[model samples]
Target chain A: MKRIAKLSTLSVLVLIMVFVAACGKSGNNNNNASPSPKASEAAAAPAAESAAASESSQPADKKVVLGFAQVGAESGWRSANTKSIQESAATAGFDLKFSDAQQKQENQIKAIRSYIQQKVDVIAFSPVVESGWDTVLKEAKEAGIPVILTDRAVDSEDTSLYKTFIGSDFVEEGRKAGQWLVDQYKDASGEVNIVELQGTTGSAPANDRKSGFLDVITSNPNLKIIASQTGDFTRAKGKEVMQAFLQANKKIDVLYAHNDDMALGAIQAIEAAGLKPGVDIKIISVDGVHDGIQAASEGKINFIVECNPLLGPQLMTAVNDVLAGKDIPLRIVTEEGTFTSEQALAALPNRQY
Target chain B: MNRMFRHHLFWPLAILAALLLFNLFYSPDFFNIVMRNGHMYGSLIDILNFGAPLVLVAIGMTLVIATKGIDLSVGSIVAIAGALACLTISRGTDQNALSLVLSAVGLTVGLSFFLGAWNGFLVATTGIQPIIATLILMVAGRGIAQLITSGQIITVTSDTYNYIGNGALAALPFSIFIVAAIYLIVSLLTRKTALGLFIESVGCNPQASRLIGIRSRLIIITVYMFCGLCAGIAGLILSSNVASADGNNAGLWYELDAILAVVIGGTSLNGGRFYLTGTVIGALIIQTLTTTIYMIGVPPEITLVVKAFVVLTVCLIQSEVFRKKVVQRWKTRRYPAEREVSRHV
Candidate 1:
């Protein structure tokens, strides 16, 4: 009995240690090991002191202290967004305190409260979801921390909760994808059979993208969507669902996927079925992810509308404007472009993510 | 022969028939099959091919539930198995080597088996509840899978490997063949040996079975191991079908589907009786339901509502007490009205 007790105790301790180590690993994304909870506090204490010192000594050129709460690295696009934000923060010389929300809205809310306590100059977060953020944004407002929404938007009725939203217009991105398809198949002699691979069902991107695509294609009598199913924005489900679509329908001309991942998955299904993807079954997907661009360059995807995740520079510029007592726009849309195979090939060499 | 009609298999079979009949209303060509280049192509074929993975997992799950145990980690085990298999093939020196793919599969299955044994050890030896014991792995398994895939979806392309998932055999999808093989092997092994009787006895009363010289602990461990092996095979089929492994979504919520399959197949959570046939039918019903959803154009968002209603209907039909009550209510209503009319006459 004593042996079992001792073993259990040792195991618990080991688990705690492993958890702390994992935290340190993710926390050290900037190459500095904040090592322990106390270490972070110690580092923050000196910064706070220096901040007070700079208040009296240097007023005009004080480095803005920015706290960023990011949704976790669920996909390549998300990680790219995080990297861009972190890099731009470094170049902009902002004291960036980053927190990974791990795809949970509660974690983002908690991180925001902590940033408020830390009295950071600006707060930025790419919300995990669209709702349930009114209270936290209000708290940040009360704390005098201007909030910036990056990569995703919030559904708060109080528009003043966020200073500005700097991200690609998801609906526009979907419209571009649909318009490309409509232009290509406009002169088709017969009905063009189209299949759709959607992102996660009920998600913002999935719903908006579907609506936008539908709006454009609704006017075209020749284009008909034979089937539409949720791929859940994952590669495995995309392939499985695409395989079924192929089996169910004898003829399929176009596949409009909501995202690059699902499109990539469908490419495999098309190849497995002994048909060329971009040529035989034309594909137009949103999100210019690196793999998707590479696939476009290889002619596996016909067109890819860009939903640029590089919102860093724009986000930082908004932060600077807010901190310098300058008025910024309530909505800042990032400029993105659609790409062809040639453009994809030319841009693939310089793709960062 | 008359008494045989009252068996549990009757209800599940009836539900399956009704579902098939319902599919015809939406999909006029639901039963159509064509030979395209010596390969079967049809919606009906898709149901069988896609449901094969679920059938394999549910067979193992039925056995576990028969032992009065639940294995919640089956989905996570699936993710891990697929991740490891894809990782090996993607990083292999000779990418298309049959030997490499075969060995990778073997290794993935073995590791999953070990994980199942770990769950069994906690439940059987440590005296933890089965749910909690398996929950430990269910929560950590995806993270482990992510670690193996290096936090990215690992995609591989190998003709030899892809054959396990997307290949056709005699005008049918290869996945259906895999399920048939697994079902035959498990049923034969369980029926031929004393294993089935032993498992039933243990499930009926673990303490009495232990007194009667049945090693309940060993039986529990064996079922979990079997369940893990089944999930590993499912993972392989799924990842092969897509030619990619995603730790997060590979088998998400499949454990629930498996449990639903077992319960809907007439295997009680209270333990004792087991039915592989019922489980197979249950898996078919589920796959058919998914196809029906798409065919009916239920809209992807509201499909679950329809699935839930169908599941509830099946459950109600399965309950003999509920059926008896319904019959009684009909008799009382009709007979009383008839009696009043006769009295008036």
Candidate 2:
């Protein structure tokens, strides 16, 4: 029994190695270390030379193998982001190997290491967190594989490790929302009592969004946030918190939510309170999701600052540019636009996500 | 009156009352109920409305806990039930059609029963531990829900379905009526029949109950099925309230909340004795505390810490043994001579 157990364990380990090797070969067959014991029939030295020769013979025609790792599908915005990355990769005709890290830093690190071992042309990932990535990224840098950061950034001081970062600026998105609000209430005289529905506390987006909005709104002392509470960035919690806000304050002039879902939820609460949402209390929110834009077009949400999730096209372009040895900037911010109720109606037809 | 004070539900009720009283003092308008469009609107009503799903889940959890079983899968079941219902409604040409809405609800409830049976079978027949059995579904059920919704949030524009959550009847939110009805039925089913006794007997000792000719396995399965049914209804209310089903976020952490509600209601983890009324009050206390936090404008950073503190205080207050020990310690500290005399005696 002991011998059998040992044999089984050894076989399992072998199986895992083979699986990893095959996954690498599928992404790019140029890796010389991928031929497992099962593929020992071929002479190792000659196989390596032929593979290297084929690779050198037609390097330009070779499909640029790209490994992109993503955080898990935790929300609609994430799903949209994932869809865009996937669809645009197909459209761009890059040999793409995707991994979902399931919102775990360790998983993302494991995936990045695997991509490095597989030796895909480039490695791109949205870091689950800012820190604890120096070691793996160092390994990638030593391997001479250019890494690209998307959606989020790493906290490493060694900026040279990554070729470029492509994503929306969350603080900028928040500033846009606040900027629109300030411009709207510019000519108005009375104190604009705003009830703010924040996202999950301590989250990067939530904290940055709050600061950016506060920074912009500080220009107008008349714009005061009466109540600021975290709705945890969900529709139900947003509705429930908005209900409490409505009950606590008799007069609320504006509602600013961190995201569209919360803004949509607050619209329901506003209506239930026998007050018009866009008319009685102007609403400003971030993330131009379909549902939020629909609400905006209907004049329920006054304005929306879009935190665009469609980073695929720009990311593909950057990947191509990096492969071509072009010096791309360290930071490439995706083009995002703000939407009014009127603009929302016009953009509703062409909205992809 | 003395017996009322000693009632199993007394502590949970008192805690709820204290929380409400605190709210009344802190925010006098918390109790303000006004008739708007022939429907009641107030912070108090909001508690019952928003809390309706939790109340339903806890009511089911009360019985499951009585059988010495924990349903950690309730949260996942909530997500699945809502996802399936929304997916069905979204597929229909007319989302608002009553038939479509009814069928969606029926399908969701039916699937929940099957999921519950899966848990029950694993526990009762296969002899798996309850926690481990439910944990399988707890993890896998969310994936199943995600599959049902194709990993996307499904939004349905169905008013008839929305009525289950947002509509009011007789100047009260319709969700309150659904909760009250379920509570009534559960109370009657347990108190009026031998089923409750059988459950307690099985909970107390499975082998002994089997020797005594009790169908212990059936009892376990029945309670889990009933719990699933309750979770399914809760999922419906939650999805209906938002008019959308979020497979990822809907009913997240609900199982822990329901279990907390059950524990707060004086239900023992060891099983046997349970109080449905206590569970209801416990759910209300939780909802009331959340509302209080928002009304008082607790800083978002320390909100969780404040909630943990309140929950801990309530749990300590609920323990009679803890109370006696504290009181005895206080008496000893206040009078050293009395302690010496008692020691001599």
Candidate 3:
């Protein structure tokens, strides 16, 4: 009995340690520690980097250390964004300390605090949520570390907390989708019936996207959204909900999915229901993910509003300007484009995500 | 009549029927089944097709609950199994090859068994609470899945693999046949042998059963392993249906749904008697509610609220005490003088 008890206790301890280690490793990538300051600075001697990097670096000996805390890899878009940031940081010859928050605001906050303690030259983070970040941003400000917001913004009233915010406007993407649909049906006579597949309810993207689309489509009374449902930003839910939508309604003129994944799922449902997706019911979707772009090129979807995940090159420029004592805009929106089948076909070969 | 009413499955089936009837009233064509391209298509067919995963998971959950244990890690297992399978298939040169699809599926199920064994080891051997033991995997399993898929959705184009989720057999969904086979096999395994009685005995009093020479610990582990196997199969169907496996979103909240199905099926959470058929009915009710909500065109924002109310009504109806109280109140309201006279007599 005593031996068994001892063994079990030892095993439990081992298991607990394993879990803690896994939790720590899964979120927050601290792998690129840059092998001490001297070696990285020596290796980063090439002045043939980005234009901003070449101009900002006067002394090759001193390397700018940047700490970036990213939201977890929840979707394809998020992972692409993370990749861009990491690659851009490497190209700019900045010592980047990257942390994955695993979709937790508390983890992001902790990462930022650690960066502050380390006295990094600059701090950048794509916050997991908009609210409850004022305190953490305030701490970074007091610590004399300038902060940059990427992909998402904090809800703090103070403008000085983050030097600049960089991301695609979700609402603007929605408006672009609505505008494209309006343009498509401008010359037509009959009312165009639309069914909306929304993202997770109450999420910033879902609320903003819905509002933006409504803001645009309400102008033209010819376009009507007969039914709307949340797919929780997932493909399976998208197909399931779309099936019901098809069964309930006899005719669906258009489908506006909050993201590409849902749109793809809806396309499958449409095909299964014996209707050609782009021809029978026009599909307008946001998020120019590779899969979404491919669908557009295939003529399965009619229009797509690009929500670009590649913000790294632009973010690097902003960081360089900040270090060079050059003033930058407070809200730096990434330039995004809309894609039709023709444009999508031409852009398919060059698509990254 | 009383015995039939008192059966464990009675309230669950009634509730499911009531839900279906409500849908029929709400939409006249709710029960219409049409054949299109050799496949059955309708709201009813969809409930069965979509609810197959939940039913499979709940069947295994019923057995685990019968052995007085809860498997909270089933959702994570579902995600892990799908991620592993999709990753394997995607790496193969010919995704459509029968050998590759089989190997991928075999590897997924094998991994699930190992994961289940780990949970069983912790719970049965170390005497950890079932909830706590499984919660470890529930938290870490998604991360492991993400690692397997490299944080990207792995989409596969294998017709063979898609057959499990989308292909029709005999004018009905192939998923329904899978659910039926599993249900039959599980029922036979538990009922045909002494396994069912032993499970109930262990659940009733583990110490007494062990003292009586029953291997309670082995039974607990076996039940959990079975649960893992069921989750793995469910994972396969889910990923195959979408032709992609999303490590982050696949099988999210499935464990809760399975547990709810078990509870609503009239299986006591305290653990003793189990009802496999009732659990199936419970799963159907849930799927039906979701479909009804969509068919009724309930606003997207309040969809959850509507679902919660329907589930609450089902649970309330399943409670014997609640039913008796309701019936007694109706009797008293209708016959106040008769009640007083009977009391005096």
Candidate 4:
């Protein structure tokens, strides 16, 4: 019994250590811990936004608190976007009240309500889904808090619910990806058998990217998509799906991935089959994350359409503009750049996210 | 030799053989392996190399199921192990140092042991159901892993770490050697000693075994710990293969596959009469099915549907009642009177 007790104690100790190490690691990287009860940062958000726009603004000493509810850490791009928002909030001297939805609609709604309860000047959130937000938006409006949508848009049809939607146009992003492919093979004499690795089965990206690409390519008689499958926006699945495509089809010329991560995975699959990725299979991908940029520069991925995640400055700017009693546009699209092999080398150095 | 032919492993091996023959019909070059950069490159090699993780997890799962317990926590432990190992090595200035890689590996195994012990402790002392107890870690482990990696894919560039995942020796993947070594250790510990008997005895009749002076509690705890250890190694292989740790998707739903492998290997969830070889063949069948789906160009959504049908077919074939019903039909119609006379004699 004594020996068993001793063993159990040792095991507990090991578990504790593992947890401590884990917590300490993330805590170090997590720049913005939970917001404090008392706002100490002077001129939180509005004041900072005014500073960037104008040389002088009245009552700069008062703090502007902005509450931002984010969709949880679902992907690498989401994480990078979170980091950007947090950093921007701090730099803009805004007391930011941040909440993570963890990819749940209920959690996000709860967060929005909590932000309203706190009586923050403005409420901002990236809705996990497009529908079922009319009630929450109405609640925010009743609370006299303006809302700003970032990265993704809600399908509420009521544009009055938000002051402005500050993110990339999904349909446009998909069209950009397709346009590059059409330009590449306009003079193609043979059929371009393209295999697409889609995102999550029915997500916005998957739906829009598919339509966007098809809208452009379907018009061309020579361009045909032989197989379209969902890799679930994962690298492993991308490789598996690509491998299967290789087996069933004797000749596959073009590969289109909804995201850079999937494209990278397909590259590995293509290489394992004793063929060069960018050379033999003309690859086109989106997102333009660091890995995708580097892959493009290395000639592994052929072309990349950029979908920028750093919406901090734009989101903050819109909130300030609204608070200043100025009319802001309903849709504000951030400028994004595309990359080829030549352009990748020039842009790879500055591509942080 | 006759007894060997009648072993439980015989059927699982036969199933694997049938799958391989089916594969041959699809692609003639399925069995071919060519020497490519000192490593064998072909469909057969890929099946074994990729199936290595499943084999390791199923080996541990076999014992757990044999003891009438299941470790759903193995999948979570895989994520945790991969996350921590990558963090440890990535944090270090010298990722190439052999010492750094070894320590990282050691830390991952140690962490896995603790997770396993936790499950064992909850089930043995606290009397929580095995599924529910392990399920706690299964859910929490992914969140913990996410916290460790800070919700980002931690990609590391170290040849030493990569060697475990991508390195090949003697024209085979390093993962195969690692699985073999672990399997040898486990079998030797069981067969060469009285450990296997005690575990089986306890699993069969815990009250009787305890009355006979067998430590049933210790056996249960030990098996769960072993399962955790196996998961830790699998986690390492998975992360190393991609050279990154993805908390959300790393080893996602792998526990289901391991459970399926154990069940398909003919190990009863009711406990007793476990066969490691059977589990190995079961793991291969699962891997081959995945390989076949890709080879045949099945739609992504239909992949799961096809897998479910295959599993159903295998389980039906293994049913004793089904087999007896079919056999009894022939006898009942052709030799009903002769059967009655033989029974009486």
Candidate 5:
């Protein structure tokens, strides 16, 4: 009993000491940066005033803060997407607040409630999954804060709940990938055994991409997805799932990945089997990330459909326009296209996001 | 101290030394250290920074395994805690410092505790295996984190929050300091009390511990809770470092790495003994291996195969069958007098 007490006491003391040290260090940092916060805010005020003036004659003091609830960084593309939005917010002069839902609906709901409490100008989120967002969107609507959907769409039927949605058409992207394959493999004789590495199960990208691809593939009888499983949109899992696919299926001619990470992972699996990735087993994937572009250029991956992650400038324009009470479209689709081997190689040097 | 030198750690240390010497001759700039801002900067520093989270998780896993339990939900817990913290602070409101910090901490700790309790309850009360219970959370937690972030990466610009993972204390990374602090605290807690003995007792014989009124259920549950808490802190560190919350990828496959670290540290998954220091060393080994592979310019794709080989080699070396064969070979190779002495010893 004495030993236990002594140990507990020691732990408490150590915790307290560490906490004190942290506090002291943080206090010093705070003191150093305390003046900069005010200075930046003051500098931001003039630009904010002009932005308000350009938008409306509404009082410049009527600041409209926006709270954007985001999905967690699920991929490199997502990280890029996040950076774009954050940079755009700072440049566009919107008092933007960002929350990472870390891919949970509950955290998003909590974020929405907090946003409502703060009485922000607008709320936006890219849903982690499709369902379970109606109640929260309705709540945000009740609070009179317009919501916007980005990248991935929600399942809510009520169009009035959100101001506008600004994202790529995931289903279309998948259809394009499928259509490309269909065009290329039209004359193939034997079963065109294809293995699919899916994105996260129950996610908007996963569901929409699958439905769109399958819808296109169903029109052609030659291309058959012998093995389809979730890679969870990760490189490691993609490799593992592809390995299992190789083990289960004897002849896999085509590899279709929902995203580049999975495709890259599948490429690794293909290489490990001493098979030529581009020639022996053609690779088709979405998300034209830098690594993916490099792979496509290098002839390791055959085709890639681009998902533009640089939605920041467009998102800011929408936010500003919405704040100005201008009539906006229900959906604003970002213009993106697929990249071939030649195009991927040519564009790799110029690719930013 | 002499007896400690005779332990199994001695062999691993010798092996590590030999590997370092081999790398020194084979690799360029293997021991090169660049000093900048009065701090060490190089591949070594990067390795430590990247490996810090794994180290933290492995240490926690060591304790849990010591009680004959496993935590597969740590990765998900990391995502959940990070999501919760980022969500709490990103409301775009007039957030009071105290309230914001408290709410973030409370939400993270509360959720983790709840998950831990669930794992504990299933294992202790319902007679479900620890692996099975944690596996359920492991599968579902990422989904839950995704639900929280609304399928988007939540990016923040809070300097206070960013400091947790990205800041430097004097010359070292904040994460390193945080990991070290945790190790010190956990070491004191286990080594300074009867908790370590109780854990070993429960692991060796649950019925025996129960007979002795050790409250085996409580101990099991507590260790799991502690693991969950450690995961929470790890999540915070990772998300804060990146300045974004990514539910799908944050701490992804971390549970596997944690398990690997624990196993490499010579801790049996079947439980019995625990070694915090061994777990730390194991983390360093994994990190160093990765660094060496990258430095040697091995294609990133082959890393998994290399890791698997290393794990296999270590496990085979520790196997009784292999050990017995090695002993026999050594005895035969040595002189008769030395062989007799070694046998007597």
Candidate 6:
């Protein structure tokens, strides 16, 4: 019994030591830590402004603190979108309380409620999904806080719940992709056996893209979707499903991916099957990501429809306009266009967002 | 008869039957099968193909759980294995069938084994909780995999590697065959030998097992190692099928699915008895449910809510109150001869 007790004590000590070691290792290898020159500049600017404001004759009224609950960095585009919002908030002189929901709706709702309790002047969020926001939005409205939808729209029937939505027209983006495909494959005699790699099944992009593409493509009887599968907006699953499609179907002419990741995955699968992706199987994808543009330039992808993720400047302008009692459109669509191989190459270097 | 009824396999069979019955009226063509390209094509086939990875994970999970331990790191291990295989093959190595396959398999298994040992060392030697110990790897494994692949999807054009994931034998997926072979090996190693008994003994009463001269710590470590090996195999299969290694997304959320499969298989999360066959059925149920949702054209967003509901219902039925109610109903509906058998038991 004594030996057992001693052994247990030793084990407990070892466990503590091991945990410390693990934590120490993680601390040394912090991946999220990056040198932020912009952050430092912004911090210094705030101090300078406060000093200048104190010296001024007129004292500033109550400060407006706005809380922005961002959907976590779900994709590269999402990360850029969040950065835009953060930078814009800092520049606009609002105390921005940002919380990343990490792609979970419950976390977003919680953050919104916390912001409401804090009595933030305004609330903004890029919801992780469309549904389950009506109740929260209603609560925000009751709390006398105006909410702005960014990048993506919510599915609330109550339009008065949100002040305004600032983002790209996702359906139009799909229509553009469809129209481009129609133009490219107009001369093909045989059936245009297309395989569509969809985004997240229930999200706005997947639903709208599917509807919009179908609306345009259904007119052409030859353009049939031989296989349509959800790649879940992920590259890995896209490749897997594409492989399954190749194994199951012999004739696949065109690949229409919901996003660049899926398109890239499909490209990998196409190359693995010993077929040229852009030549043998024409590829058209959305989201003008750097890699996607590079692929298009390299003749691996045929066409790309840009879904602009940088909405900071426009969003901030809309917010200021609304606050200044200026009329704003219910939906402010970002300016976006399609790009072919030549265009992709021309814009590859200058592409910022 | 009482013993048979109390067996873990019996619960999964009952749950599967109940789900099928529920789906029969609600879902059209639930049992419909079609032949295409000399292979079966239908919702059922799709379910089997999709559930293959989950089945593999659950089988590994069963052994781990039987040892009173859990491996939350299987998902990451899968990513690492895929990354290793893809990186290795993309290096323009000789396409000689035997060497290529062996090296890929060896590297994946070896790395996984090392990771598993890390988990084992933490849990067994240091006395850390299995969940917490494995969680470390779970959080960092994908990042490690990404580092291995340099955050790039390594695409390979190897027929030998592709055959593991995409190939078929006798009109069935090669993955299904692999799962079957793994099940056989695991069953033999555990059930047919003293390993299973030892694991159960250790799980049921750790102190007693130690008193009886069983090396409980060694057993725990070995179980984790086996789970790692299984995950490595799963990773190979996943990468091979896609013919690419995507470290960022490979086997993402697989751990959750595997744990869900294990729980649905009637294996108590608290640990004790294990049922390999039940795990297979549980995996099938999950895949079939997913396919059914897709076939019914339910919007993808509501699938999570639906899955949660199904899991809730299954858990409710598995509860003691529900079991008692079921038994009472069964007793009332039975014939006199059946009643006599029940009374005798």
Say which candidate scores most in DockQ.
3
> Highest TM-score: which candidate?
3
Evaluate every candidate with DockQ and list the scores: 0.35, 0.36, 0.52, 0.33, 0.08, 0.16
For model 1, how does the per-residue alpha-carbon lDDT over A50-78 read when each residue is reduced to its tens digit? 34433444365767788999876556676
| Candidate models: Cα lDDT each | 0.83, 0.86, 0.86, 0.83, 0.77, 0.77
Ranking by TM-score: 3, 2, 1, 4, 6, 5
DockQ-based ranking: 3, 2, 1, 4, 6, 5
Local accuracy of candidate 6 as per-residue lDDT tens digits, A1-353: 97897698688767866986786457434422332455335334434443343234223565557688886644556655665666655555556787767567898999999999999877888877788788989999999888988877889888999989988888998898888878776787878999888887667788888888888887778888877878877666676567556655668899999998788877866765567999989998988877779889998889899998767656666655655566788998888888899999999986654
Native-referenced Cα lDDT, model 5? 0.77
Q: Residue-wise lDDT of candidate 5 within A1-353, one digit each (tens)?
A: 97886677568656855985685567544432342343344334434544544346345566558798887766778867776676556655567777777667798889988998998988878888888888888888888888888888888888888889999999999899999999998887877988787887778899888889999988789899776777778765576567545544558899999998788767865764557899999999999987789889999889999998877667766777776788899999998989999999999986754
lDDT tens digits by residue: candidate 5, B183-247: 99988888899888898888888889999899998988888888888888888887766566768
TM-score of chain A of 2: 0.76
Alpha-carbon lDDT of model 1: 0.83
Query: TM-score of the candidate numbered 2?
Result: 0.87
Q: What is the two-chain DockQ of model 6?
A: 0.16
Q: After aligning candidate 2 to the native by TM-score, how far in Å is the CA of B303 from where it should be? A: 1.3
Tens digits of per-residue lDDT, candidate 3, A35-74, equal 2354234334332255346345547777789999987766
Provide the lDDT at B169 for model 2.
96
Scoring only chain A, what TM-score does candidate 3 earn? 0.82
- Candidates' chain B TM-scores in the order shown: 0.97, 0.96, 0.95, 0.94, 0.88, 0.88
Evaluate candidate 4 and give its CAPRI docking class based on DockQ: acceptable
lDDT of 1 by residue, B214-310 (tens): 9999999999999999999999999888777877678888999999999989899989889999999998999888877766656677878889999
Q: Is candidate 4 or candidate 6 better by lDDT?
A: 4
- lDDT by residue for model 6 (B91-201), tens: 746653668777888988899898888888788877789999999999788767766764456767788887787676787778889999999998898888998899888
Give the CA lDDT, 0 to 100, for residue B180 in model 2.
97
lDDT of 2 by residue, B1-345 (tens): 979978898889889989989988988888889988888999999999999999999999989899888899999999999999999999999988999999999999999998888788678866789999999889777767776776678888989999999999999999999999999998998999988898888889989999999989899999999899999999999999989898878898999999999899988989988889989988988999999999889989899999999999999999999999998998877767988999999
| Candidate 4 lDDT over residue span A104-176, tens digit each | 7899999999999999998888877667899989999888899998987788877788888888877787888
Looking at candidate 4 chain B, the ten consecutive residues that score lowest on lDDT are B294-303
